[model samples]
Target chain A: MATTTMAAALGSGLRRAMEDDPRVVLLGEDIGRLGGVFRVTDGLQRDFGADRVMDTPLAEAGIMGVAVGLAYRGFRPVVEIQFDGFVYPALDQMVTQVGRLHYRTGGTVRMPVTIRIPYGGGIGAVEHHSESPEAYFAHTPGLRVVSCATPQDAHTMIRQAIACDDPVVFFEPKRRYWVKGSVEDEVLDDALPLDRARVVVEGTDVTLVAYGPLVVTARDAALAAADDGLSIEVIDLRSLSPLDLDTVETSVRKTGRLVVTHEAQRSGGLGAEIAASITERCFSLLHAAPVRVTGFDVPYPPAKLEEHFLPDLDRLLDAVDQVMGRQHSLTGWSA
Target chain B: MLRSDVSDGRALPTTEEPPDPELVQLLAPDGTRRADPVYDAWVEDVDAERLLSLYEDMVVARRFDVEAVALQRQGQLGLWPPLLGQEAAQIGSARALRPDDFVFTSYRENGVAYCRGAAPVDLVRVWRGNALAGWDPWAIGMATPQVMIGAQTLHATGYALGCAKDGVDSVAVAYFGDGATSKGDVHEAMVFASSFAAPVVFFCQNNQWAISEPVGLQSRHPLADRALGYGIPSVRVDGNDVLAVMAATRVALDRARRGEGPSFIEAVTYRMGPHTTSDDPTRYADPEVREQWAAQDPIVRVEQHLHTRGALSEDRAQEVKEHAEAFAMELRDATYGMTAPEPLTVFDHVLVQPSAELERQRSQYAAYLAMFEGTSGGDE
Candidate 1:
């Protein structure tokens, strides 16, 4: 086992997949010579020749459309969208073609295209660079949307996403790319499926469901809650589409309280869906209504205001305290 | 509308930027054979028997289009995009392709689909709303017609790129209309195909109108000239002439297989019918222009050429007519007899593996559907 950053682990995972299968190919802008904007695909082109690791023109639609075509021809193509906001150019292809081809063809064909996007904020980036667009892909059917908060999950999930027969939208939290953890070289046979949620830090008083970047923030909130004698369970939801509601529901049922956290807008985000599903399934077990700590409904603001815009540990604890029937974190601040 | 001079009866420059002035004609509308200096060398392989076969193909395709339109009118199909005047362009290029060569086309490529060996029953499966796409792409080597304009060009380019990587000599062909050239996807495809030297053939059937918008609105110059800007070799062929289209496609395919990168062919055809069953071409196209193009009817010109050569005798014409009628009748029967698919089949292929959310919804839907079985519309 080697300790590595999330970016390095992703590169190693891609390298492992490409080594195992000759049909595995990588295509993206600046992926060949530059590794990647975040270097998530570092040294791949050198080892796997220029043909397999293609540095395409700066066109997301072309990248995605070609990936779909490559998938049609029995090649597993892993594509990288440079940033979260830049993925919109390829959304038409993602939603209409990649998402519908299998279902539209009625199971005869499969789309094994894995699109990797470095998403979310806290790197103090400019407009279009630091934005969370996971909701857009999670809402799209026929696409397996996933996010990894740890290096181990990033390493395992990327290969799992590539091995999957359906198309997957893999979102890597850009700010957390440098967060390091140990990754086993050989994935265990009983490793968790790519779509399930795992309880990172277990407790009993309240349940904190989070994914991607917010998982870290949620853990910090849990640790702070522990100091106050309120046990908080932190569940890292790996899959956003299939949602792994069973793990979340089981945890929420045991805790009898729930607080969903995400970096996306409050309305119609994954938090909303999780809250709704939890309320429907665990209605009798709940001690309080599920609360959410999420990004504001406005556009991902300029870098100066982004710190205030994103969900923080304080914001998460505030939501947790509210669900626990405690006094408001900020006593008359809103008013 | 004749952008270039046909003074020599060989060159007709439609675009301002002329890579080659000739439109590459093999047979003219006047039942005369016209040879091109470049494309004639390519069509030498096309014998009398091949010409007759192409004529039969066009005749069958036109019949299929007519039948599909009638079916749509009778409410058998949800919609139909008729490839009326563009049969020669579709059939001619498609016939040039080997069965292994994959095809990615726009929704208006029923003729190409037929040429790719999609059964008549499979053809209308999507239009009948029985399935999303009629045939399996892996079996036919042709993807389902992409409804998003010009997007298939990128897919074709990408597939061709994969072919190059796999060391496969097979080529990918992208079929789109003139209006699709204005799309970013087309431009991006061209750029990548040129940059990577991917073995892709961009076949643009310039059927003149994208619904109500004329080709003139999309391009100031001929669409073929745009290919030159991307450093790809291009050809402008008489789309109504089957031999010319075949020659152009053959040349492009040869170049692609020889690792000569990508080539573009602009087949200047016209859409004689409405864009789809929902369209009214009369609203946009002038009658006089339509009449002028109608004079250059693809199948009629082929028949005239064969007659001038004393090859299309009365018996031959009767045989072709019988073949077309039989094929059309078979298609009509198959379409009318196609039963409605089960309602729950909609949730069948949403993912390769079963999705829990979709599974839950499917069971809920099954329960809902089951509830209706003995309800008797709540009349009791």
Candidate 2:
């Protein structure tokens, strides 16, 4: 075990997967010599050789389409789409071919392709670079969409996603690439399943559901709420598509109130799905209507306005306060 | 794009693109066998007996296509895309492949599927709208017919990359139409195949149309010329001639297995039917042009060649016809007997491991369906 950044942990996890399985290969643009745009694949090429760590041409559709073939050929190809915005060009292959190949073939084949996309915003980046597009994949039936927050999950889940038999859309929180945490070198046999949510903090007044980049924000909000005498439980929903709704439902039932947070637009985001599912499963246990804190329904703005656009501690707390039926409090810390 | 009334005397292609004077041909259109020194050597093993077998395969595939089209017309099938004129393009290339070599083809590859040993029943389930896919891709070493244009090319290339990485000698072949060459996916696939030196063959049956659009509209040069830009060697062949297609495919597959990276083959042919049953060819296709291509029929030329060689006796012709009729009837019976799939079976195959949500939804849907099990019709 070692303390490392999410990026390093991800690189280590990929290295481990490749070492353990000869069929596991990594393919993407600049992932070889440059070790990917975020350095999430640093030194992998040198260790595993170019055959396993392929540096493909700058073609998103080709990357995904080829990965489908590789997967069909019985290779576990983990493709990197570089960034959140760059994934659009490959969406056609991912949604049409990769997602439906198994079902279309009536289970004759399984596409064990892991598509890694560094997603979400708040790095003060330009247009297209900073956006949340997980809903588009979660909406795809054959795909399993997931994201990682801490170095531990990043290390464990990335390998877990690779080990999975279905096609997985792994969204890495680009901004949290440098967030340092302890990552166990070896995955425990009793570790959580890749699709279940993990309760990062324990409390009772209200439940804050978040994943990927926003989990840190929700944790901060939970910590801040403790000061106001309102105990808050935070749940990191690692998986988005086959949502760990049971975990969220259990938390909602205990807390009797819920606040969902994400970087995606609130209108049709994962928050909406969680809120609806929780309402269906925990309607009798709810003390108030579920609330959500998310990016507005607009194109992601320029980097300068990202702080305002992204859901932060204040925004999460504001939703928690609303869910608790409390009046607005001006006693929050200044930016 | 200007319209021309009474546009006779215009060239068939209607473009200034340079003609492929070197289009490979092992048999002339008039039943006479012509020899090309380079390609003839590749098909030297194809004797009179193999030629007869090829003829039977094409005949069977054509009969199956006719039955499928008739079924569509009779409202038995939702739709059918007939591989009417390009039989030799699919059969020749597919037959040239080794059993382990994989195939990723477009929707118009029923002939290829037949060559890969797919059963008649396995070929029509998806067309009958009773299944999502037609056949087991692994069992036949061929992927399901991809409806999305040019997407399979990338898959073929990636699979070839896998083969190369695994140190396997098998090649992956992508069968697409001339129109697919215009897609970005095809171009990107060729680029990757060349860059990685992947063992893949991009087999394009240039049937001269992408739906209603002319191949001229899709390319300024011959489709084979596009591969040169990607640093891949390519060949253009007379698609109507089965022997030439087989020879060219053998050459390409050999190159791929030899670690020579990827190669492209543009089989020049014409689609002798509407794009699908839903399309009306009279709306866009010129009857005069259709008549000209019909004279270059792939199957007739092979039959003519066999007759000239004294290999096609009256008894042999009768046997082939009887076999094709039997296969077509079997296909008809299988398709007619197919039942609607269980509605709840849709819950399967979405993932290797069923998720909690899918299980919950399956149970809920089962309950919803069960409510109607004993319900009677309402009275007025």
Candidate 3:
């Protein structure tokens, strides 16, 4: 095992995939010579030839549309949308073509394409850099959506995503890219399933569910809650689309309280779906209403307000308190 | 913009040929044949057997089109897009393709699908609402029928680019209606194809009507002339004449295979039926206009020419009828027997590895269905 950042793990994973499959290609703007802005594709073009690591035009739609055609011709394309807001231009192709190609062809064609977008806020970046748009793709039927929180997950999940036969939207939390963790060099003997959730920290008072960058914050909240004598269980929902509701329902049933958190907008976000599903599945076991701590239902705020807008440990702990029927006043509470 | 420059040049031909520049009609309405020596080299290798096959294709395609319309009227299909008068254009261009060539098409080209080896029953799935798509596109070297106008053009161009990168001689074809010319993707496709010198052919079946909009609204100049701006050669052929369309497509496909870059062909035809079964053309079209195109029916012209040459007998015509009826009955039976897909099947192919959220949704949906089954006497 070796300690590495999430970005390094992703770069290493892409290199491994290229080494494994000659047909695997990486296409995005400013990915080749400059490494990506986030450096997720650093040293990829140098390790592999230029043909396999293409520096495409600035057009996202063209990148996605051409990738579809390339996939049709038996090429496994891993495309990178530089930021969350930049992915909107490619939405039409993603929804209408990439998502529907297999069903529309009656299972004749398989689009083994992965669209990687660095999503969510907390980096104090400019506008359009941080937004949680996972709900849009999760709502789409034909596509699969997933995100990674740790370095190990970023490495393993990306390879698994690239190996998937269907089109997958792989969202990477930009803020978590620099976090360091030990990565196993050998193949995992029993790796986590691609579409399941994992319980990171076990507790009984309340189940705190989150994913991607917010997962770290949720873990921090769980640690702080433990100090307060409240055992807050933490569940990392790795796959957003085919949610691992069995794990969620099981956790909610045991805890009798739940708090769903994310960096995406509060209204119609993925957390809303999780809350509703848990409520429906474990309605009788609920001790209090499910509470959600998410980014406000507004545009990603300016750099100064990003921390306030993003769900931090305090905000998540407050959500836990609310769900656990605690009466303590929380930090950063607005008048 | 119309300028008369006759003073500085020689007199042009004043014969009774098409006044529209770039329009080439080799076969007259009266079944008389005319030839331009420049185009003779393209058709020199085509023999009588091939010509007879082309005619047979037109006849068979028309029969199937009629059957589809009848099926729609009888409520077997939700809707049908009839290619009644455009049989020559579809069959001619489709038959011209070699086994290795790839074809991308918009919906309404059932004749082309037939030419690509898809069974008639396979084509009924989309209309019956049993499947989102009809046939296996990879099995027939064709892409799924694109319903959105002109979107397949970009896909075809990109595929051709892939072929060029691999140095393959296989050519790709994009078939669309006249209205597709107005879409941004079509123009983008042309630009990309020309820049890359991709081996592709843009085959447009200008069947006069785009739903309610006429061809005149789609283009000011002939559709073929639009290719000149992109530095590609274009040809306009009489879509009603199967022989002419076949010859034109053959030359274009050959040029593409020889790495000569993309070519555009505008097959001028007319939609002899409504846009779809749901459309009522009686509200928009004039009776006299319909009569004018009916007189130039593609199938009748070939039938009459073959009969006069003593190549088609009454017995042979009867055999065609029997074959069409048999195919139609086979399709009806297959469609009637198609069952709704299982509920869990929805989660089967979403991804190679099902996601946690999808797994949860699938189980929840299954439980919902189970609850209903337990509460009710029947599973609906």
Q: Pick the candidate with the highest DockQ.
A: 2
Please give the DockQ score of every candidate, comma-separated.
0.84, 0.86, 0.37
Q: Which residue ranges in model 3 land beyond 4 Å of their true spot?
A: A124-127, A186-189, A302-305, A331-335, B1-21, B165-167, B191-196, B216-233, B303-326, B329-348, B351-380
lDDT of candidate 1 over A1-335, digit per residue (tens): 99999999999999988987889999998998899989988899998899899999999998999998898888999999999999999999999999989888888879999999999999999899988888888898999999999999998899989888899999999999999999987663568999899999999999999999999999999999899998999999999988999999999889999999888888989989999999999999999999888888899999999988898998888887788888746453220
What TM-scores do the predictions have? Answer: 0.96, 0.96, 0.88
How well does candidate 3 score on lDDT at residue A129?
92
Model 2 agreement with the true structure over B1-380: per-residue lDDT tens digits: 11232144354443112223478988777778887879989999999999999989999999999999999999888999999989899889999998899999998999999999899888889888988788888898999889999999999999999899888899999999988999999999999999989999999999877888877677757789999999999999988889999999999999999999999999988889989999887887877878877887888988999898899999999999999999999999988999889889989898888888999999999988887776673211
Tell me what fraction of the real C-alpha contacts between chains A and B each candidate also makes.
0.82, 0.89, 0.40
Per-residue CA lDDT of model 1 for B275-296, tens digit only, reads 9999997776777778878888
In model 2, state the lDDT of residue A249: 82
User: Which CAPRI category fits model 2?
Assistant: high
Alpha-carbon shift of residue B254 in model 3 (angstroms): 2.8
**What is residue B363's positional error in candidate 1, in angstroms?**
0.3
Interface RMSD of each: 0.8, 0.8, 2.2
| lDDT of prediction 2 | 0.89
Better of 1 and 2 by DockQ: 2
